[model samples]
Target: FLICLFGLLSHYSDISDMSVYYSISVFSILGMAIIIIYVCISISISIDERYPDEFMNQDQEMYFPIHITDD
Candidate 1:
């Protein structure tokens, strides 16, 4: 709950340019907040968290992919 709220705040911080673009500390904290949100959600809601994202798993992989196919 708190983690999700922090993530939301940080997301807005970035969008509204509250965190200075030249600093790493603020961005790093926000980044961690976002990661914690995805990882710490209640297990009961995981059914919805991990599905229906079309081509991606929103909970696990938001940037990189772990496609398991013949490559």
Candidate 2:
């Protein structure tokens, strides 16, 4: 929906200032990145929950396959 709106506005309209469009694009990209990160974390957590650490060595903690954040 956002893509379609951006495309239509870019193609059909004569907007002098592109700042709004650029801002919208940046926001959309950020939104997508956040959503992807959330999905990845959620999937990893679900997998860990489904298959507990008992399968691995007792000395090790639960394995998180995807680490997106720096912390």
TM-score of each: 0.30, 0.53
**Cα RMSD, each candidate:** 15.2, 10.0
Question: In candidate 1, what are the lDDT values of residues 1-71, reduced to their tens digit?
Answer: 44555566666543544443334456677878988887877553675566445334655555545645566
Query: What global local distance difference test value does model 1 have?
Result: 0.57
Top candidate (lDDT):
2
- Candidate 1, residue 5: the lDDT equals 50
Q: Which stretches of candidate 2 lie over 4 Å from their true place?
A: 1-16, 54-71
Residue lDDT tens for model 2, 4-71: 76666666546744765786788789989999999999988898897565457444444555334466
- Against the true structure, whose TM-score is highest? 2
Computed on alpha carbons, the lDDT of every model, listed in order, comes to 0.57, 0.71
In model 1, which regions exceed 4 Å deviation?
1-22, 42-44, 47-71
